[model samples]
Target: MSEERDTAPSGAAAPPGAAPEIALPERVDVFDTTLRDGSQFEGISLSVDDKLRIAEQLDYLGVAWIEGGFPQANPKDAEFFRRAAAGELKLDTSRLVAFGSTRKPGGVTDSDATLTTLLDAGTETLCIVGKGSAWQVRKTLNTTLDEGRAMTSDSVRYLKAAGRRVFFDVEHCFDGYKEDPDFTLSVIEAAALAGADCVVLCDTKGGSLPHEVQAITAEIAHRFDGLQLGIHTQDDTGCAVANAVAAVLSGATQVQGTINGYGERTGNADLITVIPNLTLKLGVGTLPEGRLERLGPVSRHVAELVNLPLDPAAPYVGTSAFAHKGGLHTSALRRAGTAAYEHVDPALVGNHSRVLVSDLGGRTGMSMKAEELGVDLDAGEAATLNDTLKGLEADGWVFEAADASLELLMASAAGWEQPYFRTEAYRVSGYHRADPNQPGQGAHLSTEATVKVWVGDERIAAVGEGNGPVNALDAALRTALGRHYPHLERIHLTDFKVRVLDGGAATGAVTRVLIDSTDGDETWTTIGVSPNVIEASWMALVDSLVFGLKRFEG
Candidate 1:
């Protein structure tokens, strides 16, 4: 294996006489199904606007094709295509492809509602899925083998004759080919003979292994010398990405997957992972030149539009992908270089390396983290902070996921005190009482909190009421500090999570609270721990406010 000069994290010069670059494929088509198959993930429901925005992001990332949803199946998908045709959606690099199923078993292509709706979508490219497994034709669709072959051929033929590029998805092709190669090959042959532009082999059940996919794909490629081949795999067996890559190595020119691997069941292959692997690892050109660096930002943007938190540990684009926390790893990274701990240059995929400070990290990690946060820490200060971090972690305080709190701690250790208000005391109380409006229905609960604080020399007391203690405390704290720091109004707590550390203690268990806050411009996390859940929450909440004030006021 050859190593490229790692220039991202440290900006160090490359070693002399590095190995020469390996020869690689020029390009591979990236077909994104995030809007169609990705929508099938549980709890995902995209509106027309969301679909349109996601498409724009994908196009911006420069994928070859974006699979818009099945228009005939839903009004939202229909409106998506209609709006795209009316100039609501614009594309610069990616060509939008409409997704649908082939005509029904006995239906004619010209009169089939599915076919007509696909045509109405007005996309130059159309992808239609059909039964590729003998079992599916015999049992699932309850149709004869001849009808199944006809469905695949007729749909492609109709779309081709109508002046559209057609791709036929051979659903369950892996399993079908394994069970009966002749039958599956016949189905593929039918579609190819009907003028399909490409034949996509799908691991519909997501159970195919990498070796199996490669062998089968090689056979298909050999059989169809001139036709383009595509690979689509799911993650049920956790091999979706591996299978896709294996197929590509065998002969597939196109990869059909979704961003972040969002799909039904486990997920489709993640283009977020696959794209980087193809470009950086295999040296295959998947995206347009220079567009590969947009992968991380595009993945995150789409996740936000879908209202899902992108997995921090996801390969390549995840937040934690290049994060270093272990003492040995951080030491090596600091002394040696980024190549000591990282596989590829994170900048290549639009992500940066992160140094996390925690009990598991050493002074080097702490100093690196402080530098990243723009805080100057001497060796002595970093050593002291590392000791303090371990002591706090022993008491159930976690700082790895709470950067804001960690930064505040480092600043305090560095003799930089926050000029914000100091808390004197706080009190919270809750009550449940019968409501006269709904007699005997249930007890209505209410919480109230009072906070006393000093901005400079003057002390202020404020009281607030809400449905919960945290809310009431936030309201009270805001009431007390809003006038002194107007920027507090912009910092809102977006999410809160509580974890019980000493579960064996039951009611007396120590609790860890993580609070996510946003000030419209950026988001930060803070953490606190205490035996009293309320106190834990209060600690995190206060850190959140102080951090925001420091950023906004200073």
Candidate 2:
């Protein structure tokens, strides 16, 4: 364990008669389980390549340890270890720890397949889980309490004898301590006696609160005096991050969690949130001195590898973490900087403060947002743009999630026009027919679109066919602009979302369409609204192409 540090900043004087600041550990070890526990998340499925890439990202973020999966249980995990040992994966700062369970009940560790696989992993450290609760030993494992204790001790002893460091994860530690504190202590003592390097208390059920975790961790830290304690928690109660922090404040030295809180049920603790809290708020260091800035980019990159969208409102790393809206908030932000509305400087975590423009915003918000989009907005232009924004939002046009469209509107307000091709007319037609391959099964539908445009005094008409009207229109527009804008080949639509504003109107309800497009390097969103879905989609699609062209040609 590192030496304690004062919570107060240096050279800062406390008020007279104020209570003394609480001391906290100077550094805490961050153990990341994104590859093992995070893969168990409902929507995440990581291949070997994905795991390798995620491990690289974690290393870049400067986590202390990365838990690879259970090599003995699955061939995929076994192959990952094999490849890692074969020099396919190189870690810069983090140690790759192989994860598994203790030897089976009534089995000897010398011949246990699980222990042998751990030895084969060739890693310096191993983390093995064992039953901690007496009830779980008797009910889940169908074994006596003594055998459960032996399972943990024997596995630890075997791994230690092989010249490898070992971390003992006591499964259900919190519930076990509440039910039978003596039994849980005995299990932990046995692992310590067997030469385990760190004993991690697992909140397997994820129902423990911060107070409970702190008190129990304090008791364990006192009883075992000199032994390193760690914490692993789930997010079933949405308190995993809080509980982990509480344990750290109490006495735990290592915090176990996954990036973005990815796990089986609710999740494990989100290290993205936990690391910053410890570093900035609690005056504890988790990563290397300069590595804290990688948190946001690493969180986003890992989410991308897992094929899951990072939550916009997630603490520290999310897009909305530092976004300011409303008239008063934006006004205060302009007057006092981010200190008026933000807790910490967003740049500390690789994020920047943003001013969100909406109908509820004042002129300050509009001007700030326009500046962020690189559009010069004078006072008159800003006020006009603000009024125009409110009017459009009244008609169901949203620009908060459509920054590309907002940029175009701001540029138009500044007396700039899009230099792309001008649209003359467009038409779409749909047809349906019975399929010859499967009679009476279903009808086959097809859509076709024709676009006419003037590109540098040349009138061009292009036709395109697709499975849907939007797709056909996109194809037709691309065909019409391909020769003039060869860079269009790099632009692609990634996502499309639609929402109805008035359910009462049913078929005649106003529809809002949002299109997400990327040009291999930058991504932007554009939006359109209309009572007709086709017309709304067309409006958004046109904006998407124009925005991409503007970004490229500018």
Candidate 3:
């Protein structure tokens, strides 16, 4: 919603009184570095295990190269490469790449400790980078521009002479080129002249515009031949992926990025987006050329592995890619398949389509959702549902990402049976931390829940303690009916989200919580809305656990 819908396949939407022109390059390469850079986002951190899972997913999605992490940063990064060397990875065509800056201003590549760390991490291909500007050479490294250029070429040459595949990451290459095109061009020439496998132009500042990226990358492609070229764009303008695609148009064969667009500052471009653009949009081979459908699943799998929230706005593979929200958009998409608000069917990337229900929904929206749910209802049902939805929204309910709870409500309204565990004045004891020295950690939360339930003539009362109040309540409920459902072991809460519907002058505001849970086979999302965060979470938690229990029983 931030930007307008602009990318048209035929370039037919060009501004009035303007001629359409083909600007995108014919072929491109996709290099995914989500492990290295995407993890640099605010509140984003990926462990070694996270990196390994991402690498495998990227390989499956057809990324040409996986830039593992900064090997010299910490012990975790170093272990990532070591494990990759021990064959702990599952890549098909994607190669594991280790990244580090050049040895030093005047130090030898082999002698530098960081370079040794990069080598020790155990990657076949090494990315040796250096400062790309005269200003950085003098300010950051306190070295002459000539020495910096020498370091660039010398490190690349040293890696190659040592029989390693060396890719030169020209840091600040775009900004430096803008500052002094001749100088930037010379630095890249040094890497090419020194036999580096590929020269990656880095937009370190991430301030380069798309048009500027096109001309500069084209110049580099034109200037350097017989050597592969790559692009490493940052996300300052939220255009890192777009700039990478533009660079491809300028003839860069390889593109580097992180999975899910993880990285420093705003983050790196997403390989998930870039690779498809490479293969499907720009007509280039990224991986082996037939694993395109795995794109969505792989990207999401990595997100789960890293414990990072899947960004709904992520290009090509986000939850919102094929999701319908607005009334007009949903009706059109129903008839014309994504020709309304989307350019591609998300299923092509292993992502399921979604129709979001909100306050703005109309008759068409309700009808579509009912049909998707196999509910053969007429306009009266829609009108009734609309009134019900409006009433719930007024009470701060959100059903967009909370499918399970919404279904239960609909079924209940249609005269479904009452819940098995009818509440009988349940109470949760307030929790007190067990102190820092105790085994529990990170703001300790202990919960004891008391519950009473009845099944026909049999009645039960149980108490349970868990890591949190919600968990404890669910545990007590399950214990009360342990005989009815024994296979309720794997049901778990995967992710939780809370959003305030109205944060007005009121001291306590209305909040909505979304819970994502998975059993053995598929995952489901449920939601609860309330003025109290804890209450909302409990509502979602109960729905998830009870829904799974009912499904198992059936």
Candidate 4:
């Protein structure tokens, strides 16, 4: 291989030993593997519908390419491609790419099932992974080195000849390069010779460091001049993002990653973190201009679509990424701006600064937080509120996760009253009945609730039945208020979480209930705590209703 020097683009940070900047191309493709690789995460199971929805989200986020799924893997994946082929799944800026492995051992190119599935996926682009390490090809696949090379070369040649843009993923390239330096380079040479449009060197095991990635990438970039190069790294060593950056610095033109770093094992490199670093920090162009700001919301949207909770500490997108809970940090942040305690402006990624109310918050922090929460507060009142909040925290009230509750508390302290409806009383009962005929169905549980509320002096009582006590209460409350506050129909409880504050008390423990409600346009979380779980749940339920009515009606 030639010893050509490779460096970063002009004004971009140079690699460790590059003499001249390796000028970046006009645009680097941001390929998203969220739908395919993201499903590899434990507890993540996506139906065919989920795959299509995730692809649409990735395209909306301005990804250049979306690896839909492995078409040959299962019926769901194949159906996804079938729907995509029929133009059922629409995309804006992203081209859907089909992912698969190269031709099987001793399989004819014309008759290979995997290759046929790739062609039938109806995607203009296809990404096929092939064993790159000589040891993997020889031992894992039980094939000779020449046959392994032929598998990759033939697959690429066949796909390219069919007019499909083929990108070959050299799986375990770093490990291969370490074991047999010459054979690894030969694998890439075979792909380029076979007319592969782009060659992606994949750190499949994700064990390569930044220095090792840069050194090997420098060599590959120098040797492969005709083909566009890319980097696909995993996160086992926690260097996936760093390795990806190193690869780009060494002249790679494309980056492949999953949103929120969702993939197998430790997961893939996080495109949410990588795009900002590449475009904002490295000055390399990716996505559309100004798309970086939508990253935070996009990350959250993906998590929600997959039914996975967002990691609040996730870089750039997490709720706590720009949240300040300390008095000193909040005070300095307000005085010196976000740069005081943050590396980048939170708004740059569509995230905003948050000052959490806690024992650590001082009067200044409380005043600033009050302003954010739309609660008018003078310095004296802020001091009082700060002291009151500390006292509440000490009493087991967590205001951080209950913003609606905190807002209501602040409004009440500021003499603002929300007298939508007055609840007089409520009663609930549960009964368990055994099924005599259907023994396999177990016991049948039933609940009934009765609620009475006064609206402008007119008291009304309503009875409702449901599967559980909380559900029955919600139904009864809604029934009682349906005629008076018809807008309550629009509000529904989306999530309900319960936590026992005193576990030692066991059956008699004090419990906290957090109720999340949404009224089409917005959502709010309200909390309540009490020794009786029913009482706690009712408090939160009523608060959620009041918060929704106040926002939507008033």
All candidates' TM-scores? 0.94, 0.95, 0.86, 0.91
In candidate 3, stretches whose alpha carbon ends up further than 4 angstroms from where it belongs are 1-27, 70-74, 108-122, 418-421, 428-448, 465-469, 494-515, 530-542
Top TM-score: which candidate number?
Answer: 2
Better of 1 and 4 by TM-score: 1
lDDT of 3 at 513: 86
Q: Rank all candidate structures by their TM-score, best first, as comma-separated numbers.
A: 2, 1, 4, 3
> Please, what are the lDDT tens digits per residue for candidate 1 over residues 1-554?
11234555544345689755433346789999999999999979999999999999999999999999999998999999999999999899999999999999889998999999999899999999998899899999999999999999988999999999999999999999999898899999999999999999999999999999989998998899888999999999999999999998888999989999999999899999999889886778898889989999999999999999999999988999999999998888877777888888888899988888888899989988998888888999989989999999999998889999999999999999988988999999999999889987999799999999998998999999988888999999999999888889899999999999998999999999999999999999999899999999999999999999999887
lDDT of 3 by residue, 1-554 (tens): 11223344654355977755645545555667677677777776777787777777777677667788787888888888888888888677777889888878778876888777776777788887887777778889998889988988887887788778888888899889888888888888888899988888999989998988988988888788657888989989988888988888777878888777777877788778877777766566766645888988887788778777788877788888777878887777666555457666565677766677777777677777766765555778777887899789789787877778877766555556645566565778867666667665656668898888776667889998888777787788778777766766778777778888777836498888888889869788888888887788778877887778767764
Give the clashing residue pairs of candidate 4, or none.
Answer: 7-22, 8-22
> Clashing residue pairs, candidate 2?
none
lDDT tens readout by residue for model 4, 194-237: 99999999999999999999899889989887679999999999
Q: How many backbone clashes can be found in candidate 2? A: 0
Candidate 1 lDDT (Cα, 0 to 1): 0.92
Clashes by residue pair, model 3: 25-249, 31-255, 33-257, 33-258, 34-258, 34-259, 37-262, 37-263, 38-262, 38-263
The TM-score of candidate 2 is 0.95
Return the lDDT, model 2, position 219.
92
